[model samples]
Target: MPDADSNPGNGDGREADVVPGNQGGRASRAAALSVRSLAVRSLAVRSLATLRAAVDRIIPADSWPAGWEGGVAEYLTVDPISADRDLAWAWPELISLAGRLDDEAHRAGADGFASLDPAAQDRILAVVAAGSGARSFDALRRVCWEGYYASSEGRHPAGLDMVGFRGVPEGVTPIEPEPLKTVAPAVVQAHYDAVIVGSGPGGGVAAQVLTAAGKHVLVVERAPYLRNDQIRGDHLHGKRNAVYWPTVGPGPGHPRVAQLPDGDRVLDGTDDASVYGLNADAVGGGTRIWQGMAWRFMPEDFSMRTLYGNPDGASLADWPVSYEEMEPYYTKAEWQLGVAGEEGGLTRRMPRSAGYPMPAMGTEPSRELLGAAADRLGWGWGPIPLAINSVPWDGRAACVRCAQCIGNTCPVNAKNGSQSTFLPRAIATGLCDLLPDAEVIEVRDGTGSAGVTIMADASTSPVELTVSADVVVVSAGAVETARLLLASGLGNDHVGRYLHDHRTATVLGESEHPVKPYIGPGHSVATLDHVHADTIPWGGGVIVDLMGLLPLTSAGQPAPGVPGWGAGHKEWMRGERANLFGVFAMGQEIPLPTSRVTLAAVKDRWGRPGAALRKDVHWTSQQVEDGMAVQGARWLDAAGITDIRRQGGPATASAAGEHSCGTARMGTSPENSATDPFGRVWGTSRVVACDSSLHPTNGSVNPTLTIVANAFRVAEHLVAEWPR
Candidate 1:
């Protein structure tokens, strides 16, 4: 029998109890009891020997499976293990280590790894498991863990329900109405019951609901649409066109700055036109570029004061409402967004009201191996709840299982983004009008009141328009929305303050087996072990699959000490692409008054004041690094991998720092937060800022679902307060 140490618990930290050989036992018990006992014991011993032999044939016995696929052995077959130079360089070393283990075991009169004493087995594993040499055992471990938990077989052992998923609240149907025909261009200026700025989650949902409520709505987007066949059927190009891409070097267009080591700052403000990461400027905003991993912040997340109380140097405060208050809205977002997956698992956080709209996406084979390893480690694993349709739902088709879903738009409409789901339905109701490529430069104060001034290209000629209404909604995302408010001087002092982003760190490795990485959603699984304060004691973090790599992005941004190009580089790329797997440790960045967005002296193509984003994240760096290391290690152990490589610490820039928030926070007092609980701008009656800018803190999860839910809450308030 395998020793207790060898038999680790599942990812959720539960003992693994595999049913004793029942392949044909129940039917043939009577005939084979006596003879079967002896044969079965012999077979068990032999099978154990074979497993050991296999382990010894490729790599060190101590180096167990680190990811979903089990180990480096399994990964090499399915993915590109030799692509990464470091991984390839370590291949021979791993083989040699395996041979040494086999020799050592044979000298001890053991046929294979299983025959060796448990202590000896552990000793042998210790050597290669240290992963001190050329290859990154840490990276391998992460891939194996991710691959295993993401597979069907692995999901089963982890107690993940692959088939059934209870989704959002019932009785909440899409408010679909009739479509309004486009008005004649020359007709008197068309009137609308409401005009929504920005076509992201909040704006999209608002448009759909208001139009369904029999009100005429106009949806305005600053970026041009990139759907259909205009861009070679690749959604990435569309995303690039819509998102604000920053330059690589210091340039006139660069609006952000990063402080580096040696006390010198590496100003990203280079003249190079190559774009870096930022929020999407298209109709769908960040949703078009997001990986679609949806998760609800724990009940405790909203009430930080009630849970851990306030901490110094942070703006931690309890939300105006509790989880129960937003519970119904959460369900509404789930159903409307068409998320797919199971609920009610021991490892998950949120409660479910009904099953998912469709089945879960297919699991990768690598996940199977990692699941087994996790079971041995006594950790719990669960199906990843995602905002993606696994089957046809509400006129949209199912996902095609592409590996490029990360940092790129879905070629098919399977991914439930605002553009594909809410906006279309809202447009179908003749009550809504979509004005693409219309940039609102300022929110013109309507003679001591609130209104907006918008600029757009009418037939490629600059056209300016003024809109006056009883209510004005601002949903221009965190950075842009804050800039717009500041530019218009609506609330300049509060507009660009308290900017925050989820600080991110990464771990990468090469596994033993092939993990077909590009087949499913970029992130099909995650671990929330440290997502709450109880786990980290000081701060919290969330773990998700690493974003897929584009060749240029990967080569250009190699990990420290990794060669960029050459024989070594080519080898590294080959292995890294196939066998490599990564993990992103995302932690909530505390809201700091110093970290802010400001208008630069420069101007954009539209002659608007260019927004300069300044981030000083040193305050929360220590907490983020510590939390990530802990959770990352746990995942590695669960995947049964010993070798590992990690990058990101206090010194590293927060990963992308793209999910920026808190520029216009929400609170009861205008002195602290920028808006009220109902998203109403303080000191104003009919002006509301309904976007991520209202987030008090960038909670340790994706902010989309929360943004949408809060928007619903705000809409309800607006309707209630509407002039009778």
Candidate 2:
């Protein structure tokens, strides 16, 4: 290990007091603002005192492998009161709640939580952790473990030697924050051919294709260009870092209010438990962080209402464009992005026009292990189709086989996100100018063109900037794109309507040796047997294998009935290390009219209304999701993996806060849809949306590739329509 000064906890000269923050996927990145650092802020004394006194009890030191490590509970304290507070402040609130509960307890005679004796504190905390104060307590305990378990103190704990759980966050490659490539407002000579908002899959491809067609393209992205240092794969940073760029991003100040059955509630962007509607914002967008599984929707996906016959209460409709028209673009995206894997014919899957640019990655023990279970159950499982490179294709390097694939930025630069795949080419063409951190607040109709008003690099310096374009393509995912269109007063009738996502059911289990889940990419193998099967009563889901969990993430999540802290929790962590497996069912939900995104009444920091996401997934979709759960549980049972429990409840839209679509949907008319078949806003030829919002239904597949393909298709129209 490093010198004695590095570790200060153990008596024999280990790291001292567990480093304030964690050494997650980003070990080399400079540490900043530990929970201890929060103590220096306002009300810091009471928060720190309350946290220090309670962390050991919430996560007892003796109960853990180490004798005592004191930094974790402190990691739970942050002061967001000074912040704009639109971000996830579960930590600050949890710490503040600790102070609140302590005050209440103090009034009842015990001084405070910190001053109370161990037994009394435990009694109060247990009730709070399991009762009305549960949200805060549970959040506190989780972050406490997120900091502790990922630390040097928690990594080399007593019994961990047998489990061989060293905690994730292995290597560290330092990188500067990606500088904002700003577009000088004075440089534009005239109205550009196109302006694309949101540098995600849809916009990235559209910009590339349009620029290649010799059109001047100005691409405005809302998030800063995050350098490698900014994106660490650590559970603390990648999984639990809600303060900034949580998988759902623009970290703070981007509020997405939800209209619920009870009433409209403004969502804390950071809290995973509460926020149902989710959208990702970034220079690279969802492609930057998504688990790179690029499956194509079946031909039936284009005509869901026709094929399935629209169920009552669900606002399903036929796409104006058919699968045949989209086929060439799909072929182009796969080849251009250098997708891997082979011909897919898994159960109810669709036929493809061509094979992948490269063959699937060489087989590992996971396929065979999961395949054996599939064989026993008569299910068809195979190597999952992936955008990740098996061997170096194009100029990018091959995947380094780092298990920390999803959510974490690729240190080796192998994962083919649209940001890396298309934006580079678009920029290289010299005709495309990308302005990162430019939040497009409004897109209005200019004289024979479209006008976009934005705050250039809104993160650091917010300066109002407006630019005119011949065409405007808003691709800020489903929610944000809809918000922009509504704010711009285009597509006001249908904008921000029909929101949906792959209502998923996570089935976590433990395998023996054949499946070393913490090895390769996040998702490598999957079964498509359940999807759209006649045998199944409802629409089915895809079951893909995952790269399990880090010790920090897994430690916080005890088995179904086990207590989250103490000896039982520690022992449970040991048995679950390599044995753990992630087999999840991504079920399709019926998109309802009520499940929509509207402009919130309150304005955000940008002076535009925040996105108001309202979800009411149909009951039949709930049935399908429930059916998928049982089907996935059976798959795990057949594999002899134990501790199989369904992660989420019935009919709930989404938990991971992503893969949402259908809002601002495409169709034949203005009343029912926001955009035309070519992604053109109804009644407006030049204005369009190129994101998942154009999708009328999110088929039983990931939508990134499809979004890219559809964008390619739309860009062709924009090219042909432009004055050559």
Q: Using lDDT as the measure, which candidate wins?
A: 2
Candidate 1 lDDT at 291 equals 60
lDDT for each residue of candidate 1 in 180-227, tens digit (9 for 90 to 100)? 233322321444556678988889888777777776766777665544
Worst 10 residues of 1 by lDDT: 1-10
Q: Model 1: what TM-score?
A: 0.68
Q: Which regions of candidate 1 are displaced past 4 Å? A: 1-191, 228-277, 346-348, 445-450, 553-564, 575-577, 605-607, 651-656
Q: Give candidate 2's whole-model lDDT.
A: 0.66
Model 2 per-residue lDDT tens digits across residues 1-724: 0000011111111111211121111121223344325434644656556666666665565534332353443233333221112112454655566676687678769777877777777777777776677777766665555455553311233333334433333563433333435565445434677888888888989888988888898888877666754564444324322322243356445666666677765644333322533345667787775657887777777887877887888888888888888888888999877788877545235656777898887777767777888899988877877888888877767776665566667776777877678888888889888887667888876557777887774655567887888888888888788878777778747777778887666777767653764466756678877777764444677777655555555665556766677555666666655666757677677888877777778767766788777777677677777787788788888988887877645535532246878777888878778887788887565687898888888877677788888889988887887622
Model 2: what TM-score?
0.82
- Where is the poorest 10-residue window by lDDT in model 2? 1-10
Q: After superposition, how far is residue 378 of candidate 1 from its true place, in Å?
A: 3.9
